[model samples]
Target chain A: MKRFGKLEYYFAALITITFSNTILGEGFDSTAFITIFVALTVMYKGLVVIDHFMELKEANRYLRMMMRTYFFFFPSLIILSTMF
Target chain B: MSSIESSNTLAIFPRSWSQQNAGRVPGNIPIWVGILSELTEFGIFFTAYFIAKFNYPEVFASGPLSLNTTIGVSNTVILLASSFFMAKAMSNVRRDDYKKCERYLWYTFICACMYLSFKSYEFYWNDLQGFSTKTNEFFTVYYYMTFNHFLHVGWAACAILWVIFRLRSGAYSAKEHSGLEALAVYWHMIDLMWILIFPLLYVLR
Candidate 1:
């Protein structure tokens, strides 16, 4: 069971989001690669919020899994479609 | 300023509040409804965006390039900082540091203001650059999606102000701060939505 302090998770998310811009700026040839990277970064940020900021670290498994699934599944499809 | 010691004079939360509400939904049920509705509304817009993007790849690809990535990144940082302070306010409330909580919320409000400042500048700049809802499919989606979110931020700003007033009025405590927690969750949802929107609209170009 992994848990993070709220401030730590926020910093982690800020860095991830800010960092994605660099990859995106590298020109369009690698847009496909950065799309995948940005998708996964978004997922990680969502999971951190669900787990830490929302304090779902100890919530019911059903609710936890539900939010997790939505965050994981939907953005994923968008990225997949963008790439393919 | 009401001191925490003086706060003890008021009725504290019943000791079993946590144990009683254990295993329930994350926060107050009504907030979950608000959050879900917001998510559903954004979902529809995002679907339309992607559908339009797929059909008009050239426009979607060129769209973000015209927009200023610097403003987008800075706005994201400001919003994340606002969310950070909001979370800190919640943790302070959990610790019975009502004064500290109120201070953190004010900080969050300041960050919200800063976010709006950058956002306003971006919109003004876009207008000067001749981008509008009628410019093209991409701007249509961009203006609609971003403006709708801007509306939510307006509501969130008002809510934070109200909560700050209530915090000063001695309306909450360590063990009985569900309303504060719910507000924090809503703000976090805004941050989460932007996490998706920032990368989708600006970065993934």
Candidate 2:
């Protein structure tokens, strides 16, 4: 079952991540907190998909590094967009 | 073995016995070139969306309310599931489990269709509410962001279909599955782009 490992958890996490953020967001008008939470989860979810699903965990260092770095960097642009 | 060899111009990792060909992109150079170019184009589109949003924060923040968050979240999950199935298909292909690989591809394709249908419904709902690309700057960016992704999804779905057909013909094996891997990578990239798009467009109020 190595192939099936954590597949369910990823699904559960994806559902939980989006809904919790969407639900918790209703309570706070604080855009910063909401955005920070979303960004963190975006990074979390993106990395998970990259390493686990894409199987890039064992991939070439350049591609792995670039792909993971892209996850972290993309959200920064979103936050910066709001600032500027 | 750790580093890939670069052309004579520049080498990344040290020239080692095991890594003699490490410089090449994974899943062949051609697909990497295509994926990178496609990502760069989307990167520009995303940059444009954010710039427009920056100029009109009020419009941006207020726009998502009229749209359904549930639908957006569902679409995101759907795409993620599709990516997972594609990944599984790739793994199965790697294991030479040809029949299961084809089944997984079918699952991924079905998931893709579900996502496209749901997205189409969302677009219809927006249109019924008079939300068009011409609505305003916010709607303009929203349309661009979603539709640009929609177009990519179209491209991915087509590629997936071709990959499925190939898998059906038993053209891929454990050692010769680079084509399948390339399609999987492209699909994952589509999923990757949407993870950011979903929150930025729908949830970041």
Candidate 3:
């Protein structure tokens, strides 16, 4: 079971790479939309890993909250700063 | 007979005989705090990357063009494999298998070396092409973000080496291996940071 979970994580990583590359090959105007969408997808996948695989949900609540804030805020801030 | 018996009894509680032994075992802090600190540091670098991208999107686009995706993907796999070895090392330490722990640690070290080697090659290639920190805003952020990650890789390698040495010396028992715990956490942080970096810098437009 644990081995399967690890393999699934790796599969997700490969998908992310493929998705990002596809976005990169598009035109700039199209690239921005794809990039944003890809970013969101990456963020969602990361959060799922943190919450489930990494067992953050079972961890200290304060720590879990801090991680949630750090992950969401940092990436969102980066994307927004870039876009605007 | 009485004096000899008394001295033999004192051997088990030798700690009461000296002040130095009182501090032998240090306090064990949770390893998660160290991991969090590293995550925050990487966050700052990511923020800088974005700020640069906002100010100069063209430069960012050009910078990505120069990056060799082959090397990027290879390094990503190396780090991912290293994470697995690190986890195995931790598991071995928990199981009191010092030999297996050492083997896994050595494997992790090799992966770290591979990562550093590829990064050095990239840096040399970039430098030869004149894509330096002063080239443009994009190059500046690229160098900064990637170089900072390289530094973390170095630190992690050193930590892994320390854990390996301690394991070899039997300093870490199954019941108490905080060093291994801390290093494993640190290794995961390195992997997690690269996950974001590979996409943002190499793959994304």
Backbone clashes in model 3, listed as residue pairs: none
Q: Is candidate 1 or candidate 2 better by DockQ?
A: 2
Going through the candidates in order, the fraction of native interface contacts each one reproduces equals 0.44, 0.55, 0.11
User: Could you give candidate 1's per-residue lDDT for residues B1-205 as a string of tens digits?
Assistant: 3665333222243433332343444557678779889988988888888888888888887898888888888888878778778878888888989888999899989888888888888999999999988998999999888888888888899999999888888888887887887888889888878877887778665
Give the per-residue Cα lDDT of candidate 2 at B126.
91
Using TM-score as the measure, name the better of candidate 1 and candidate 3.
Answer: 1
Rank the candidate models, highest TM-score first.
2, 1, 3
Query: Candidate 2: lDDT of B69?
Result: 80
Considering every candidate listed, which one attains the maximal DockQ? 2
| lDDT per residue (tens digit) for residues B1-205 in model 2 | 2232233212333544122333334465567678778778878877887777777878887877778787898898889889878877877888899888999998988888888899999999998888898988877878888888898888789888898888888788998888888888888888988988887788776
lDDT for B120 in candidate 1 is 87
Instruction: Select the stronger candidate by lDDT from 2 and 3.
Output: 2
After the best TM-score superposition of candidate 2, give how far the Cα of residue A67 lies from its true spot, in angstroms: 1.7
lDDT for each candidate structure = 0.77, 0.78, 0.69
Q: Give the least accurate 10-residue stretch of model 2 chain B, judged by summed lDDT.
A: B1-10
Residue lDDT tens for model 1, A1-84:
757864775677666767655556545554566677778878887887777777776864555776788689767965786664
Q: What are the DockQ scores of the candidates, in order? A: 0.40, 0.53, 0.18
Models ranked on lDDT:
2, 1, 3
Interface RMSD of each: 3.4, 3.2, 8.6
Query: The CA-based lDDT of model 2 is what?
Result: 0.78
- lDDT per residue for candidate 3 within B1-205, as digits (tens), equals 4764543232444534321322221112346656767787888888888867777877777677787777887897787677767766766777888888899899999999999999999999888888788988877778888998999999889988887878878889888886776677567667767767876787666
